[model samples]
Target chain A: MPGVLVIAEVADGKVLPVAFELLGAARALSAEGAGPVSALVPGQAHAQELIARGADVVYVAPESLAGQMYDAWLPAVDAALQQSGADIVLLGQTASLGRDLGPALAFAHRTAIAPEVTALKLENGRLRVTRPCYGGNARAEHTFAGQLQIASAKPKTFDALEPDASRTGEVKTIDAVGQSRITVLSVEKVESEGVRLEDADVVVAGGRGLGDPSAFAMLEELAKLLRGAVGASRAACDLGWYPPSSQVGLTGKTVSPTLYIAVAISGASQHMAGMSGSKNIVAINKDPEANMVKAAKYAVIDDYRKVLPAFIEEVRKLKAQG
Target chain B: MNIIVCVKQIPDPETPASSFRVDEAAKKVVPAQGIPPVVNPYDPQATEAALRLKEAAGGGKVTVISLGPESARDAIKHALAMGADEGILLNDPGFEGIDNFQTAVALAKAIEKVGQYDLILMGRAAADWDMGVVPMGVATLLGIPCVSIAKAIERVDGKVRVTRVLDDGFQTVEAPLPAVVSVSNEFGEPRYPQLRQIMLAAKKTVQVWNAADLGLSADQLGEANRWLKLEALYVPKVESKVEIIEADSPEEKARILAQKLRADKLI
Candidate 1:
């Protein structure tokens, strides 16, 4: 059987969170007798972490791959796959590199492509992948009978397999078509405060109930004290109280945090789809009967003006003691 | 300045979801015909932005490219109706199931094949899959700086100033000629295509390039080069029932709600 290739994205000289997630999934898939799970980390980084996370073989290219330039990375990935003899390749869904690079790699490799896949399995030797369609309203299953299969794994939906401290793997460099046709003239990284919504372990989102954007300060403070991120319902975003980036719904980022706090959110199905997977949830709204309250592990019915300050105090207290 | 706007044809998502189905054996989405396809919402915004830039520049050429089945002509026509000077459609069976990466490569190839454009414009994300990855991939393939989620773009002599919507607020950046930008819906509503222009768009030639014509090998077109896999697909199940708490009096309702809030530690 052809071995599986796991493409790990390295950004700003660091292996991204999705790399570990892909490793875990690749390991599980390989364990089921699909093929060997070899990781392709196309940057100047140590591959030991990949090996520890269950990558049987790791490919590393030091000099030309460190930057998150898609132009440079595409050829690097193509070179790695060609050398690895991987018939099945996997990637993280929508990582900084994965989003742009994943599809290009698919086209380059001429393989069937599936993205936002939430689950994977092998049935009778065929590779099976599943992803949401119709804006999370339905799910579709795909099985590639061809020799090669490629898919992008959904983030925050799977556990990152634990690394074996003692596990060791080999790292080799592969020659690629060098000299990128495109060049990154310059790069500017945006500065952000508090936890990034993508990286947050906890997220507190508000809706129109917060009244205005200024009131979002309370949610921001609460998020800061919790070491989490703040989000808003589509309503809040539409009301111009928050930027679209902070909006949580079908059109925004799909977040699955350890704890999700919903305040004054009406719990539209689309918004729920984005965050329904949060391990624990709490909701606060004036409506004693709100859809979000039913989805919460804990529910509160009160004015945000009264409850927000108290919650902030409690979080501050917890942080202070720690 | 030559501005190229890449557009896509998609089933009108606003059509109730119930109208579609999967041809599992065929491994394809069965299109619900009769329902018209439109320019992916963001593409028009990008086109409008390009038009504005052109209008501001006094005059310039606006070329639109769309890749899909032959039906994709509708998308190109839509762009042409909106004042694009020319349109091209890349139609071929080999392009089916081509993921974002290949789509970008094909697009980059098309742009390169066409040759000479100062700016490439695109929507921040597509309605289908909504991965928002194409413009970046194309930029990478073309080796240009890509600014996504752009709310505005203004051309000033040698460069373009872009207002990017960041998570917290916004940031303005300037880039020299030859850059890729994915315009956001917030860029402003797109203008409607005029009647005479619509008629002219139909008669104007829509250049069709196939996988063969683009020199894209079968391997470079579809699943053979795909690098990602969907592990599984099932309807996300999240069920919640309404919570109704009736109060006898207005004051009592407020008190009850307040009590619930306190219990949850939200107040």
Candidate 2:
């Protein structure tokens, strides 16, 4: 039985939560007779943390392998894959390293990969998956032609297992490196103020229909009052009405908050792709026929300018009463 | 500094969802009837990036390349209209139904045929498939460094310096000449072509090449040579069961909606 290997990703000196999600998915496949599960980490010894999350074995590459260049990091990754004997490999996302390294590995190894898989299943030692296609308007179901498979899952699609301090796993250090062709100058991680949009339970987003940048102030106030975060449609971000950091769309962040509020949004397919997974959706728009209004679980078909202030006041009154 | 920019043409992304259709049985997107395919949105920014790099280098050739049916020439022509020096269209029946990998292989061969370039540029992603796989794929085939989602690209100390957009922030990295860089929309708005430029571009050199021209064969192209098997493609059914809150007044509606949300424990 071929094993499953997860490329554990680290950001800000800690293994990303998505890496644990990969392990969670891998452990399930392992339980289904895919053999053991391994987490491949470079630059740091995250073995104990990963094992607690679900990895059966952790392969640690030398610190040098953590260098940002995709070419410079390929060799160690290849070695880890070989040593772990994993026929199926997984990454936490399609952005960052996954999009770069996933296709590179597939091309280098002369194999195929479905890099943005959102669903996965193991059948008779083959990996079957479904991925968003045609700009989130559709999904493509794919099955590998051979046993050696590579895929990267969309973030937030899988659950991360709880840490088990008693769980034990092996840590094997790999020795290999690749030729470096790129040099990093600086990495700036912009720490957002307050709750991060992706992690926020409630999100109040505006769109171009807001008509003016000042309208975002109302949204910010509402978000603050609700102790949530502010978001925006791509149109609003592109028009500079709000920061690009707050843009919610296929090209931006994938958010699945418990509650997502859309103000003056038309709910383009791309925008829907990002926040459609929210547990509840509320649309405030003047256009009764807007796609957002139709897709929303609850909709107010009136001018957001007229509706939002009163809505905020009502929420405040409701909170005060309770 | 010679630069190669790969462009593509696809159905307009702004085509309303109401008209967006996919044939489940055919496993294909039924092109929206009224919208003719336009140049992929990102490719112009790529062409603009290349044009700017050429201007900065004082003097160099900017060649635009596209791999698709003959209609793909519009993509090359769009880049040319934006002041690119020349265009190449890689078209062949063998190119049909090719996956990203095969597209990369054909493009790599075309780039090699185009010969000697300091840098290659492409849109961060094709707006249609939303697959940004080709740049890295081509880079791997050519054994060149690839920088993704570059908001800015400049030449410094004979290396390509890229300011990249991150999920939460930005990072700057430098790679040597002959590298591949995917230009993002953040690179700034691409310049629009004037009427004269469009006419001049129409008269500029537009080379049409087939698989044979690139030393490619039917055996090495299309579905037969693909690696990933597509089992199905269909538009997901979106059933809108929205509950419209009805009230005589806007304030009343707001209060009712808020109360409803509070009742549901959403707040």
Candidate 3:
């Protein structure tokens, strides 16, 4: 029986955390009578960690597939699919590579891809997946109808297995090198300081209610005090009050931190979907009935400008007392 | 140069969650009262990308294509108002309840019928289905390369250069002409048409073509031809339970909320 293959995504030579989460999901499928779980690293990577986290086999491809460029990654993934003959393949649902490569690969195979699936199961030798749709207002369960099953799993939807050094797996180097017709002129990486939004335990997010770009300074201060990262809503990002890299919504980064503080956000369905998995939520909004306030476990129905400063000060005092 | 931009009309994504409803049995959204459908938010960004490329080329024809219901004409008209030179609507009863693959088939057919194009532009994803696969599907069928999530698109020596958004950063890549590009919101706001342009767009004849005109049969278009099966669609029930912090002043309210967090061991 063909099991699952994880197309582990890489950035700056580091295996993204989503790779391990996908292995966890793949292992679950294997445990349920699907065959062994194999991982495909499209670049140079250590197989020990992936193997420790449930991958039975790891195929490391050439470094050309390291970046998110579709043309660079597609041939390697295609070759892996054919060589491994895996029935189901998974990729991290990153906006850049996964979104671009998954569909193109599926189309190349004369099939289609299931995008941003939250949950998936192995049912009667087929793959059944649930994905959010309609701007996250609804979820649609889907099944691949006798086609090669391919999906981009949403980040944070699955937990990475606890790594165990005792586990052992085969690491094979594959020569399925990728060559792209597109010319890469230049590459520019955004200079980011502190924890990335995805890795942050606490996320202090602001919205259009901040009213001015300068307000992000205070939000950043609070994020710094909490040793967390700061994010923003689509509206605030579009308004140029914050960088688009920090936007938190369906169209932007999907963040699921331990604590998500939504400041002055209205909590549009799209925004909530991105942060819905947050373990706990707090809202500071003047509107009592705002969606953000309603969804929050703790809410202060007052102007964020009025609440944020004092909230920051109180948090500071409490931390100092400790 | 000639460019094609695909647009879609969807129920307004800005509708508050409180008013959004779904019929689990029928698997459809209950149209919120008095809210009209609008073009998918990202479609305008794609349109902006197309318009910018056309303008940069010194001269080019930008045609907007939409595969949707009769209301989809509004989406086509939207692109026209935003400096598109022509509009085409791929409308047919057979087009209803089709998947993205079928949608891509029809759009690719329409592009073939148009007979001339250097680039195809589309939003990264539609707000309704939000699958964002049609562009790639079309590009694949056409045997052209596709670059998605473009923040900037330029005509570099007759080749299309796109600055694409990646998971962590950005990369600038160049593809041959007639390639497909899907624009993201980072491309910046689209140009809002002036009154005169809107009036002119209203009068332009939007050529309507059905599935047959695209040489597609009814059997090739709808539910039976779908690649993926929809098992169930439902509005997930989300219970909102909030503990409101009440106090005489903002400072007091802040202090109380902090105390509550400490008690919960969250702070």
Q: DockQ of all candidates, in order?
A: 0.21, 0.74, 0.75
Worst 10 residues of 1 chain A by lDDT: A177-186
lDDT of 1 by residue, B66-140 (tens): 999888888888889989999999888888776666788789999999898989999988876666768867776
Top TM-score model: 2
lDDT of 3 by residue, B154-197 (tens): 88888998998876788899999889999987788899988999
Best by DockQ: 3
On the 0 to 100 scale, the lDDT of residue A253 in model 2 is 81
Per-residue C-alpha lDDT of model 1 across residues A26-58, encoded as one tens digit per residue? 788888877888887765455888888888888
**Candidate 3: lDDT over CA atoms?**
0.86
For model 2, how does the per-residue alpha-carbon lDDT over A1-322 read when each residue is reduced to its tens digit? 4799898767657777788888989888888788899988875568899999998889888765663666766787789888888899898664557767787788888777886677888877788888786667788887776557988866776778999999998999888877778788998888988889988999999998999999999998899888899999888998888888888888888888888999999988888888877889999988989888888999998888889999999999988987
Candidate 2 lands at a TM-score of 0.96
- Going through the candidates in order, the fraction of native interface contacts each one reproduces equals 0.21, 0.80, 0.86
Q: Which regions of candidate 3 are displaced past 4 Å?
A: none
Better of 1 and 2 by TM-score: 2
